[model samples]
Target: MIIGIPQSRAFKWSYRAYVTLFFIYLALPLATVCAFAFNDSVFPSLPWEGFTWDWFFGTEAPYIGVFHESPILRSLVTSGVVAFWVSVLAVFVGTCNAFLFVRHEFRGKAILYVLMLLPLIIPGIILGISILVFSSSVANFLEDATGLWFDGLRPGLILVVLGQFSFITTFATLVISARLQKFDPSLEEAALNLGATHWGAVREVTLPFLYPAMAAAGVVAVLMSFENFNTTLMLVGSDAPLTITMYDRLKLGSTPVLNAVSLLLIVVSALLGLVSLLLQKRKD
Candidate 1:
C-alpha cells in the first residue's frame, strides 16, 4: 500500500493522467524515430511503409545503409574520439576541482565556485561564439606577434573538445564534489597515520570512494560531448562530428537512414545509462 497521505479519487486520477501524458510526450518522438528506422520508404515520415532492413543493411545506391554510409561512419568515429578525450579531461580536472573545493580552504572560494558554474548558465550558442571569437583573436595575435602559427588555437577538434569541456567539467565537478562531501576525513587520516603518504592515502582510500562518481561524471561528459551541436559547430574545422553531420543531412532532407542513426544512438545511450545505474547500485 502507499505510505503517503491519502488523496481524493479526482486528485489520484489527475496525477496519474499527468504522469502518463508526460511520458507519452517524451517517448512518442523516440518511438516514431525508431519505427521509421525500419520503414522501407525513403522518407522518415509518412504512413507506415512496409518494414525492411534497407535503412540499416541495404547496399544499393539510394538505399545505402548506415554501415556503408562513409560520412556517417567517419563522423561517428570523430564524435567518439572527441567524446573520449572530453570525458578524460573533464573527469581529471573535475576531480582536481572537487578536491580543491572540498579539502581545502582558500580565499575567494565562493567566487571561484560561482565562476565555475558560469558556463552552465551561459547558453551553448553564446558560449560557442565566445570561444570562437576569443580563439580566433588569440590565434591572430600570436601569429602577428611571434611569427609562429599554432593550429591548435584555431577552430578545430581541439577547440570543440575545449568548448564542450568548459561546461561539461562543471557537471563532473558537481557530481564528484557531492560524493567527496560525504567522505569522512578520518579515513584518509587513518591511512596517513599508518605511514601512507598523502598521495597514497588518497590513492588507497579517497580515490576508491570517488571511482563511482568519476565514472558517472565521465559518462555524462561523454554524452554531452557526443551530442553537443552549437559549440561543436562553431569550433569544428575540417572534420565534423556525428551531430554536425546529422544536422547537415537533415538540412538537405529527412531520410530513414538518419532515423537509423538515431536508433543506434538511442540504443547506445540507453546502454550507457543502464551501465551507469548498475555501477551506482553496486557502489551503494
Candidate 2:
C-alpha cells in the first residue's frame, strides 16, 4: 500500500507538471508578442528602450516610421477584403446547402458530405497549388473557347476568394447543419397547417433560430480566411494579404513592429467578439 501510494502521488504530480508545461507552450509566445507590441524599439521584438505607441500610431525613431507607412497597413486592408468576401460568400452558399442537407432526404447525400469535407482534411499548401493550377487551366480554356475576361490566370484576388470559398463553405455548412439538426419538424408542420406558406414558415420560424449559428459560423470563417497563409501565398495577387506580408517581413527580419501588428490583431478581434456578444445578449 505504501509503495502504491508514492507511485500514484508521483504520477499525479507529473501529470500536473505536464499540464502546466503544455499551457506555457501555448501561451508564452502570445504573451511575448503582446508585451513586445508596446516596446519602443524599431525591431518588433527587442530589448525595450522605452515604452511607446509609435508603432501603433507613428514616431520619429531612426529606423521606425509611422504606422500607416508600414507595409502591414496595406496588407491589413487586403486581408480585410479577402476575409469579408470569404465569410459572406461562405455563409450564403453554406446556409442553402445546409438547409438542403438537413431537410431533404436525397440519394447520395453521404457521398456529397464526404466530398464537401475533403478539403478540410487535405493540407493547405497542396490545396493552394491545386487551386492555382486548376484556375489557370480554366481561365485559359475559357479564354480560348469564349472571349471572356478573367483575372490574371495566376496569383490574384479571384483565385484567393475562390480557393478559400471552396473549403470555408464546408465549415459554414457544418455549423449551420449542426444547428438545423436540433430543429423540431413539428414546428414547421404546425406552421403549414395554420395556412403559412413554406417560405413564410422558414422566414419567420426557422431563420431566427439559425441566426446565432450563422453569425458564429461567419466569425469562424472570417478568422480562418484572415489567418490563412500557405493558401493565400499561392492565390493572393501583387497586393499581398497580411499573412503573406508578414512572411515577407520575417524573411527580412522579425521586429517589435511585427509584435505591434500582432497586438492590433488580438485587440481588434477581441473587441469585435465582445461587441458581438453584447449585441446578442441585448437581442435576447
Candidate 3:
C-alpha cells in the first residue's frame, strides 16, 4: 500500500532536487576542508598541488602540523580541560534540575523554569559580555573591600566554563527531563516500599533510568563547550580554547594545519554523536 501522500512527477523531482542541493550545501564545505587537510600546498584553498601528510605530521617550519604545533596542542588541551569541567558541572546541575522540575511542585515553578531558560534565549555574545561585566564588577568590589584580588572572578577558563555552563546546563536539563518524564513513578514507590530510603529509591530506580540521558547530555555538553567561540572568546584569558586559537590563526592566515584540526574535530564530534545515539538506543 502507498504510505505518504501521492505527489505529481514534477513535485517528486523538485523534492529530490531540493534534498540533493541541501545535502550538497551542507557537505560541500566540510568536504573542501577535509580535502585541503591533505593538500601539499601551504594554502588551504584551490589548485590541489599534491597529496601529503604534512598538515597532519610535518614538523618543518612552514609545514608544522597540528600535532607538532605547540600553541595548537596547548589550545586543544585547554579546550579539553574546559569541556571536561563544563560537562561535569552541566550534567550534575542538569540532573538536579531534572529531578526538581519533574518530581516536585513549588510556588512560581513556571516562572522559575522560564528564568532557567533565559541563558539560552539570550545571544551568546551578550551573555558573555554580561557575565564578564558582572564578574569584573564583583571582583573589583571584593578587592576594594578586602584588599585582596580574586583571580577566579577575572576573565579566565573558570569564567568560560561558567558562561558555557549557563546555557549547556539548560540543554542537559531538557534532555534529562525528557527522560525523567518517561519514567514510571511507581518504580520509585515500589523501591521505597521494598525498604529503600528516598535517596536510595532515587539512586536505585530513577538514576539508572536517567543514566543514558545523563551520558548523552554530558556528550553534548562536551561538544558544545569544546566548540563554543563567542562566549569563550569574551571570557578567555591567556589560555585560549581551540576555537579561539583557530580564530586567531585564521586572522593571521589560513593553513592546511587548521584544516587538519577541523577534520579532527569533525571526526571526534561524529564519534561523540554516535555514542549519544548508542546510549539513547540502549535506553529505548
On lDDT, the candidate that comes out on top is 3
Q: How many pairs collide in each candidate, listed in order? A: 0, 6, 0
lDDT of 2 at 205: 85
User: What are the lDDT figures for the candidates, one per model?
Assistant: 0.92, 0.81, 0.93
RMSD of each: 1.8, 3.9, 1.5
Off by over 4 Å in 1: 1-11, 281-284
Model 2: per-residue Cα lDDT at residue 202: 92
**Which sequence of candidate numbers ranks them by TM-score, best first?**
3, 1, 2
lDDT of 2 by residue, 128-162 (tens): 99989988898999888899877667689768888
Off by over 4 Å in 3: 1-6
Tens digit of lDDT per residue, candidate 1, span 1-284?
Answer: 76788889999999999999999999999999999999888888788879899888889978989999999999999999999999999999999999999989999999998999999899998899999999999999999999998899898999999999999999999989988998999999999999999999999999999999899889888888988998898899989999999999999997799999999999999888777666555544
Better of 2 and 3 by lDDT: 3
Worst 10 residues of 1 by lDDT: 275-284
Q: The CA-based lDDT of model 1 is what?
A: 0.92
**Candidate 2 similarity to native, TM-score:** 0.87
TM-score of each: 0.94, 0.87, 0.96
Question: After aligning candidate 2 to the native by TM-score, how far in Å is the CA of 96 from where it should be?
Answer: 1.2
TM-score of 1: 0.94
Worst 10 residues of 2 by lDDT: 275-284
